[model samples]
Target: MYNKSHAQMPMDRSPPFSSSSSDSSQFSSTSSSPAKSMRVVLSIECLKGSSKADEWTGDMLQTGDIVEELRIGNMIVKSPFKNGKSGIQKILHGSFKQKETSIRVRVRRGCADLAELQACIVPGDQFVGRKQYVLRAIDDPNYAVGFIDRTESQCLDLQASRTSRMVSALERTPLQDGYVSYPWERRLVEMLSIPNSSSFYSVLFLPKSSDKASARYNDLEDTLARAHTWINASQASGVPIVFMNIQTESLLTKISGDTASSTVNAGSLSDLSNIANTSLYGFEDYHGVDLGVVRAVRLWFSPLAGEIPIEIRIKDTDTRLGFAISRTPEGFIYISSVIEGADDVPSARSGLSSLYKQASQSARLLVVSRISNQKLLPWMVSATGAIRCFDTVSLSQKLSLHRHTRVPILVHVYLWDRSANNANVGSIRARAMSTSPPTPPSTEAHLKMTARGVEEGEEDSDEEETVASDGQEDITIERDTAGEFSFRLHDFALKNNWV
Candidate 1:
């Protein structure tokens, strides 16, 4: 129906149109053109205690405008203020307020040049790279429709592809019955097989238990190795790794010198110094790892374990029983048993402090199990802090995201509490880990230092030589930090450099 010239003419401008008509034409041109279709990402960070939700609006926003959403990314409010759910809905409603200034917004366009896009741009770069701009009504009457532009950064999730490598390589079968259903794990596996181009965040869970048999010691070596491999790969590729420690249970079962089912309540581990430090009956072979670190481990009670004298689990406001959540330096959050009934507020507060210490500090992986009650909802939010949640397929999907988009993939351990029968508690929870990523080059330097020490062990102590990958030993040797054992390996490698 249109003329041939109409199709060939420039699309952004109006031809012989009035001012109002021209404005409509401009809006239509911008909305329909492929040049306005840019990919964007959004992230949220440190969102806690039911604060205000970040909103995005304006019909003029292109595809690539929203890049990242983080807890403490560029876009953040200086103070902690309460926000309602309507904020996000407001964005959907295209309610970019040009009047009451309260929120901040940032927007930016993607690089047009192919080289710049490929050499430095990333999947979430169009959004994450720039500093967040405030959404003030004063800055242009179109404040609500304004876009903030910022710089791009290297995301860990867009660079990994071996999310399933650990799962596929493992020879052990999953615990059929005793194990809690960690949907996070399942989600990670699924995501690894099917990749995405975005930031990946997830958690691994360690169920609460005083029983070492349920500790999965057999899988310990494999699990630890898997974490190492994933962390190593992530570090090599600029991804961050958060590892959570195991949680301990406070509910004890008094044994009648019988089967595993027979038990009693011994009490909470919070009073370990007062508990007589008595050797636990079934825990004779148990090492001090579980009960040692209060920050990394949490405790809870189990109905299946029978009843005992002392009860350590906390009772929530709803009387559904609660437990404390804590963290370790390796990014693991330890969970405790729940306290049901009432009147034990003292123990609950103490346990809560410990849980908060971990949550507020380092934990990245969180566990969700059988405990039920809405009173502990605030606690759950506190534990998550600045972390993200994902299904079992998250890990894999994260790997794929990293591979395709150059984002970092965060690793989390997740567990579900069977004690929680309520449906509203959600499927997964997470905490950040106490992890210190080591530089590969530093590791190599240490290895070389160790090798030199090993070589020195065999040489004439008075006249030793430190040489590179050469046969001639012409360099003088110096020992600063490492001992003789370190040099022994170097001498051995030097002797067999060809191999």
Candidate 2:
């Protein structure tokens, strides 16, 4: 996982390199785009299993790195790759094998034409998952990606065309807003029904994390892209967007700073000061929107004072980061999870019960708990109104249910016996494994696993146990990766008129 912060790129900037073959006759056109040119720097995790340290001396080249065969001081050196991956082999298996190894690559930027470079190297299955170094395109200094190990810093330049095209997609997506709520589905639907109610809506955005920075999926990019789409669509449709800007406290530092503060504000995203400098959601030049910082507000905070609208607050209660969509006499509302919390289903349900009582008088509620916990099933049936209960055993099953429900759902995972510190990533992994199919080994499995391991925990690990930093077995119940846990819970709430 290569993690980077969210900094909006300017609009319509020309691609740093010429796409024309005449200008770039030397480099092959196989690879194009900023993401393609990124030289994914291998990290300590990448070399974790190596029996001996591997070395690189520009051993390979990205197919897209080709430029005119250079007469560098009258020495003709040819490039050996195309499009970053092994393009010569049409066999899919060959490509998978190439990505499993760690190899260095250098992408040449100027002098057009890759014919001379391609002519020298025999194309085959050698460069599959080989580590690549993309030198900065001459056009844009900021455009470069590769394995940047502390021991060795190698890179390859790319065409300006790659940068322009890659960054173009990023520019179109502007950050908007994010949200979260408790477990009560009815409460979420009711709160989300309020229109243009800012105070009740707490904007949620993903903060940059150390794990996130090194993450492979670029969650910030994905998050920002989502925000952009949501804001654009909602604004065009006249739906108000409530965004939450919550700060994440580093457990490591807080322990050293003051153990007392750590315990007082340990698990929740209550602290607003720990946010990274670049973790804000804003465009480079957009000036129309005011309020420089998105607020760290939650709908739960409103009922205490009774200032914000109750409908918006209801929507904000998305426990398990579930999803919800409601159509009431008031208006249409979409409820979704913007961030996740450390609470379990039982605790979340309690908070939600209180919130629902505040938001509406005749609100109905729907709930979903792990089917494995048969004891908890009856408690759900005891809830107010016609509570619809689903017997879902895993998160993936919850997603399957979501495909059919347009309303929000509440998903609960119980780690009642687990501690917080140990509850780290293992909990999320358990949720994913419980819902999805196990991956079968393939030729590319080594590279793919190593790549994922470098940034995130392995999906297939023997140990299902997780311990919190405080030596507590952190127990967590969450929605599956598909986000259906939330959706299903909310849908039940609306269909049964929980709110």
Candidate 3:
């Protein structure tokens, strides 16, 4: 039944080249002129048969025939392929998955002869699978037509390129720009430049081998020591340091059967390091394609130069935290205002008073990095350069509860150094100033409170009196105004909280 289907396989009737037999004679006659190069084509070298070579009978395919094109099912691939033998093997592998019965091949009898022959290849005892056909490129001695070998029942032996091996290693690693450094050597992969700054982020790869019990312990110690060095260097230079460790495995196989696909395995240190200078730096497989097995351990180091860590312990009698918190458009939380002359408040006693005075005089901001041991700074950046941070509303509510319960709050504030050339400071100041909201006009009640002290119990009575005065002013303004009546009405409503 299979033989009948194979025999009925469709073939292309049109020839790839001219059918005129006098073409070779015309080429020999033109030899007196400039010699032209012949187009390269594939040829059948040797076939593996049962006993000796060329044992198969009734087969239309013969040795030394130039392959014109190959067709599997509805898909057809012409000659002079870019990837050569590898490209053909890939097509065969895909066809195997589709369970294709046969493939049609068009070939030329000889270079001097223009006769085209078509043949159908099917699975049998001699050629058990599609991968059994091994093709290789060969140089033509005549320099007229180069030949690429097409054989059956042979294995393909080819080495993967260095870039391919590096790409494979990077895919196996769990983190971007990470590779396993085997044999206990610390190697720098690449240095990524930071925008608007002279400093750079260094990428390094460390290896973790579990072959021996002592090797694991040694790797751990080395990682810790390297982390300490990075942290210290970053602190001393007032910069940030980040590193990730990639753990790689050995001996990974992706072949489902005797034929292997184009999947590359990890290689030696030289092979993996060769990609550092290429354009593949910082390459990541965002699609989650399977390459190999690997593990990642990440470490982050933040600058500690101008950071001030303060712990504020609230007392039972303290009515407020004595500090107002506001967020910039850039999603940074900062101390917008501080209550003055309140020596008994928690903020006054926690040394925030000095910091606030210094910040006010210097016209700088007190950017809060952490509150109550919770980090409030931006932890991630999106592709559009937008920062991700904790919500300010929830943080303010938590701080209000802490003040009501007299709980201590630990805060980490970043102070910008005026003498230093800090790009972050300049960026923050520019963005804050550009996106700052216009200040609202002060109310008459607030002015009165500032002039004469009003107790907490008298606040409601003062508000009632202010509302009555505002109503009388609104009525008087309406009677006296004519052309500017609409503006007066809007101003009255804003002042009396009618809006």
Q: Can you write out model 1's per-residue Cα lDDT over 94-180, one digit (the tens) per residue?
A: 322323223332222222100000011111223322332322222222212222221122111211111332244244424335667
Please list the C-alpha lDDT of all candidates, in the order they appear.
0.26, 0.26, 0.41
Q: Which is the leading candidate under TM-score?
A: 3
Count clashing pairs, candidate 3: 0
Off by over 4 Å in 2: 1-200, 207-225, 237-485, 489-499
TM-scores for every predicted model: 0.16, 0.16, 0.29
After superposing all C-alphas onto the true structure, candidate 3 shows an RMSD in angstroms of: 27.5
Q: Which ten residues in a row have the lowest lDDT in candidate 2?
A: 1-10
Tens-place lDDT digits, model 3, residues 118-190 = 3233232243344444321111111111124443111011011223433564576453275775642222223
Candidate 1: misplaced stretches above 4 Å?
1-240, 249-446, 450-499
Q: lDDT: which is higher, 1 or 3?
A: 3
Q: What is candidate 3's local distance difference test score? A: 0.41
